[model samples]
Target: MILSPYLILLIPVLYLIGWIYWFLKHKRPSLNMPRIISFHKISNTPELGGTFNTVKQFESFIRFLKMNGYKTARIDKILAEPEEKEILIFFDDAYENIYNEAFPIMKECGLTGVLCPVAGYIGKKNLWDRGLKRFRHMNENQLKEMSEAGFEIISHSMSHSDMRRLNKESLIKETTESKRTLENLLNKKIDYFIYPFGLYNENVKNAVKNAGYRAAFASYNEKNDKIDSFAIGRNTMYIIDSKFDLKIILERKPLFLFGHEDQKGRIINWFSRFSAVIKI
Candidate 1:
């Protein structure tokens, strides 16, 4: 595919504007406060969908974080110590691949991750999603072992439905019952919530807060005016991301330094919106 002359000429203009925007934004005290990265699967599965990271990529990224003096911590710790090199690692969907692959790697680095599993899908394959490469969600035993090993297991949702489209009664159950389900299974308090598909509104946030979750996380799609713990946003990690892409993502990097791959990430993230339309 070749770019048209008009589109080609317009690219630099867009970057110039984006650069100005980036400069003004970062010139302040700093806008890269909540540095959280969310991952789906941690396997070398073959698929057109670039969701899972290979074991090698996962290990390299973790090694890069350690080399840069970063430590994985809970969201609460990250918030309390704002200036520290603390990051929150999230393994959304709680796939068995994550337990089999990412768990040991993180342990080797003396870091832990927060696991957000769909309460109803535990011990079952991800039939709710629209994909050819279906994967299994961690069973109760796998989840329990990780929780005992110091990984935090929290609610992704009861059935992993879109919260923005649910009714009041269904909304309440998704937030409240899911937490109850996980707490009973893990025998520990489930404090935080990660919105399925990263979709939520005021009602969703209120429901989560009322459900006894001290904080909740949204994906990159939802932009917040400030860091609202109930609606905090997290960066998503894709298969194509490299160490340099991760650097630009960790900080609100300069415009001139932002590369084409980073721009591709922004475009790819648009696919997340498809979740509202389909099970994917």
Candidate 2:
């Protein structure tokens, strides 16, 4: 077998051509849907996951919404209202950065976000994920401050465990008990559920609905074509996402353009099944 050094270069060129062809030939659709973007952490420091949106990225996102005339909806997230341009920024895991970093940035933009806190891990370091990322969940007082200031507080389950395999009793504890914990802590009715690690099934959805939540959101597992209240999908923002990627998503470009990132997230979710026995 004879190989030319130029062959290696030609392979990349071909891939580049294919990528360009695929990107341009596809028609990008501006979806008339609710803008529900999800974020995990707010920091420039690197972590084991791709979910961090640097402080600058967070501020830019809020500013982009404000400059584009996007308003933060104050009602229950997509429960009663028909789809509109109203943006609902969702901060999953309720990292303290949401309070120390993202809260003021959003407040300055005259916007607020939906904060999903793991009820059991409030004020404690996240022990749910497979690693000790040392990420701290917001404390009770911080959560109350945001709630009082108009941020929606909801449950990311009780312990941030993988709930898809739980029995009815344990699932109820994860569902209803978490909601009750949040409501009791915030002194407000917790109206929605954000599944832990965005992992859920029909039984999991049933657990959420049976818990009396109006809707349940699963992160990074949705397409705009169908919006399910119980299985609503959220677009997750990552540190590696380019500014152009953010622009296309905000403009509602076709999901295929940047949706591979989401598929990666789903793969991460599957690996979380080992969180109980491993620490990576």
Candidate 3:
């Protein structure tokens, strides 16, 4: 069926309006700063009630990053640097599956990564209270083994709660106590900290610095030319079954850049909700 002239004319106008609306809503200056992309948690058993990354998929991501000229630095090394690189991998919540499955493969590939653990959750119950299912925080023996084998063990948090939502006392305890615990366990200094849930505020950053942390990782994915050295950004790689998604992540310069200064998860959560609505 042929469309009427009036209907056809309105289509272009509608398209233009939609485009303008999207542009304004998402508008922000493109950040051309150096970036360091990384993945968190490579386990066969899920944590926090989330699905686990298959061994195959984890391997594929490592291979992809290596081919693209990304290097895995200990969290301390990355934080000590003046600028970030194209790729940097950090594993959150040092689970046994990483040592059992992913570690061997990563060594074979000659890739290094930072392992950030919740020091209080190693032998304790799930501190996040997300329910019990394969809680795999590394014990002292495992931590010692991994530390000797060249994996950098760092701090995630004491209890893995959102830092921005915590009080000053809780924040201090989370930062200082976790560092002390990990240092005592591994017999090494814990300099790098990964914020639980990638959540933080200025107060949190100050607390981390005061606690003697050299660097901290946030969930914000953006080029960090002018990023606060204490509060660096990291990108999360999800367990998707598409090479195209990988390609997009690798090719795009600002795909992970954050637009809001205060709300770290706002942009990502909006996209997640939108994708669900559109069935993408």
Highest lDDT model number = 1
Better of 1 and 2 by lDDT: 1
Q: Is candidate 2 or candidate 3 better by TM-score?
A: 2
- TM-scores, in order shown? 0.87, 0.82, 0.72
Local accuracy of candidate 1 as per-residue lDDT tens digits, 160-263: 88788999999899988899899999999999898887778899988998888988887742332356677776667788888888887676455355434334
Q: For model 1, state the Cα shift of residue 274 in Å.
A: 1.6
Clashes in candidate 3: how many?
1
What is the TM-score ranking, best to worst?
1, 2, 3
Encode model 2's per-residue lDDT on 150-233: one tens digit a residue.
999888888877788789899999998998888888889988898877778899999888889988887653544556778776
lDDT of each: 0.78, 0.75, 0.64
lDDT of 3 by residue, 1-280 (tens): 9999999999878756754543365443234422455554465554332324677888887777667766665554444452433445567677666677778888887776677778878844343424235356767787788788888887998887768888999999999999999998888888878887666779998999999988777765333335666667654555543344555444543333232221323344344334323421
User: Which pairs of residues collide in candidate 1?
Assistant: none
Give the Å error, residue 54, model 3: 1.1
Candidate 2 off by > 4 Å: 1-30, 75-79, 82-84, 130-133, 221-223, 254-278
